[model samples]
Target: MAINARHRLPILLAAALPIGLLLIFESKLTKGADQVAPPTSAPSPPIAPTPTFTPPSGPPTPRTPQFAPREYACSRAAVAPTLDGKLDDAAWASAPWTDDFLDIEGPARTAPRFKTRAKMLWDENNFYIAAELREPHVWATLKSHDEIVFHDNDFEVFIDPNSDTREYYEIEVNAIGTIFDLYLHRRYKEDGPAEHGWDAKGLRTAIHIDGTLNDPSDVDRAWTLEWAIPWSAFSPPVLTQPGFTEAARNAAAPQIGEEWRVNFSRVQWTTTLEGKTTTKPLTAPINDSYTQEPPKETSVTFPYQKVVGKPEDNWVWSPQWQIDMHDPRFWGRVKFVK
Candidate 1:
């Protein structure tokens, strides 16, 4: 191991060279590992916070009616009608008959096969309505009060005193004078229920059939119906809850010159008499002439009649553009006159 100084120095230099080379290689490897290549794609945008969602407060607005609503000048009655299902009284002379009813779906549909007309009058005590329906075969089946009178040929009245389309009143009466009355907080489309228990208190209705009822053998003339609804019946019950007072209720009677939303509907069915059934559909020819012969004052009979083919026809004073009678937005306007 004890060599000359020059030889020993040369060996040491070789060993140091190898070690230095190894260290250089190790340093290069570490530098390459620490270095990073440019990203192939843009760094993902910083994740954005999800936005909060909110819902509408109420139902969407309904489409406007295709046709303009009809209007009527409801005049004050000098004398209350006798409420005998007859429009012959002098009190009705001042009131004008409404235009003939058309298909509930509007003028786009065919005219009603039979003629129908109505008139209105109001007094301090009661509101009067009279309707005349020309039917070839006057018939009725359901007679129970509050029964679905529309199941039979029926006349219906809808009234919205505030014109707000809320808390409206509906009264349906059949030829037999069966009454089905209810109150609605909103339209059926708005998920409102018919409060059948709410009734038109002190309501009076009468029906006069000109032809023999339920008899298929004879061609009947028409049926006239009358209603006298007391103003007090329209007064809503007083709410006893907080923020409520007796003054919250509307006046018993409408003030002069006030306007209200109103509409009328008639439901007619296709029917045939038992044992006299025909294969042909029970549709009457369109009566071009709205005029009808006067009643003969003959005795009427109630024979069994069977409903035949298609569904009932809905004829209305104001065309709904849709078959729905519950939408007060399409109802006609009635301005109270002195």
Candidate 2:
């Protein structure tokens, strides 16, 4: 055991030197790996995008109202007779009056049949309109000219000379000698008293009753009425044309054939079996004419007649009288027959 010291020293040095070298290399590798790499994290999924929101729409605009213009309907503009000829059986054959008057109410209780006829004629001085209502019983208790004529069985007339569906006129008469003259339109509020200067100038209405009108015992036969409307109440012509104002100075203000708004309505009442007066339609017992609202399916128009020359014309509302029936503008132009 106490052998040579040189042999033991060489073995120990070789083993100890290799072990220290291995430890130093391992420590350096661990420190270098920690400094280079970052912390670990899980991968994320892709996102979907969102859409924008919008609101809904609103309502639509309204439409304009229209009406039937009674232009050519008025006999004043017609070339035939011109509504100024003398009233005789010959001229009466051609007037626009309806023979079979109608009942206003529905077809439940028909009004008694009556003979109704009308005529129109004009002269150098005035335009004339007449109507004759032949009744079975002619009894009139009311005698006032301005009172309600339809309180008893009566006949009514509506005149829209212009026939523009606006600014027309209406009149009512009963067998009892009562007369109700009124202006009409699409509205009632626009109706007012006849104008002072706006006279039907030579207008006249005569009622010839056939029987006792108001007497419950006797029956009325018939009633007649005559009217003469002058051309003075129309609006003055604007100097819109040459010689228009000058021509109107001496000549009639409204030239011949100048039509105004006009229509006729007959409100007739019947004595019911219950001894009560009822509102009857303006139709004949055989035929009903009062239920008509006019032929609206067709277009309406009015033509101006050139009396002396084609004089410049003026209307109550504007270039031409046109408006909504429900509007007040139409009634304001009521010029009454004085």
Candidate 3:
């Protein structure tokens, strides 16, 4: 097994070369492992705490109920009543009187000083209205027809046939039977003007005063009013609207079981009569600072009684909740019955 020195030296060199190569590869592998980056993962999300339920502190609040307008059943007259201010006609016997008038601003305000009630009847041709207003001092000033009748104590009737609150009719009459009738395309608050030119043709009105008129001397019982309004009187010129037809502009007699919106109002003013007085003129001053003689002074007296208060009282069949009467939404529902 012993070899020559030169051969042994060559074999050892070859073996040493293989061993050196292996050692170099192992060293390289060790260095690569140290240089390698560590495996990394995304940071975990923060854990959330559980929520606790807390009840409300107090009881729940209650809601207000919606307001509903009053209703009336208007009966039909078997026969037409005579256009007299008296309610003794057989046609009005079946008609029931409306509730006593209340303040226009509702029951929250003071009640009306006098009692007022109205009844309604309808025939084939006309709509009838009868009112009995118990007033101690009955007086009126305006006389001309179509003049502002409300200037004097007056009774007013508002009718919305279709209950649309538009194309309504208003008729006002005073104790003297002076009438102021008008038509409105819409409510006055909606910037609509009163069509004074529109008159209720074929309209009949009568007034009867149980007490002396325009005389404050004695206490009077009451005044009564009767109205026979033709159904044709409601037809005016054709009025156009967004969803209205030509026939809708013209009014027709209401059929049985139909409903309409209606309201009545009474305007009363506080008045007093001033006694006539005579005054004598004083003699002109001795020192004449005036260019001409001092004007003679004479007594002056009003021919009629004077109104003491600035605003008149407004009594209505149904309270409007506000002072405005043009809002037909608050009017009572009148159902026509046979």
Q: What local lDDT does model 3 show for residue 126? A: 86
Q: Which residue runs of candidate 3 sit more than 4 Å off their true CA positions? A: 1-66, 239-250, 273-309
Expressed as tens digits, the lDDT of each residue in 204-310 for candidate 2 is: 44444344333445444455655555544233223334322212223253334454443333443333322333222222221111112211212111111111111
Q: Candidate 3 overall Cα lDDT vs. reference?
A: 0.64
Model 2 is weakest, by summed lDDT over 10 consecutive residues, at 21-30
Worst 10 residues of 3 by lDDT: 21-30
What are the Cα lDDT values of the candidates?
A: 0.65, 0.34, 0.64
lDDT by residue (tens digit), candidate 3, 94-150? 889999998776665667878999999998888989999998767666556676566
Per-model TM-score on C-alpha atoms: 0.69, 0.44, 0.69
> Per-residue lDDT of 144-177 in model 1, one digit per residue for the tens?
6666565467889999888876768888877667
Off by over 4 Å in 2: 1-99, 104-112, 184-186, 189-201, 233-261, 272-338
Give the Å error, residue 182, model 1: 0.4
Deviation of model 3 at 112, angstroms? 0.3
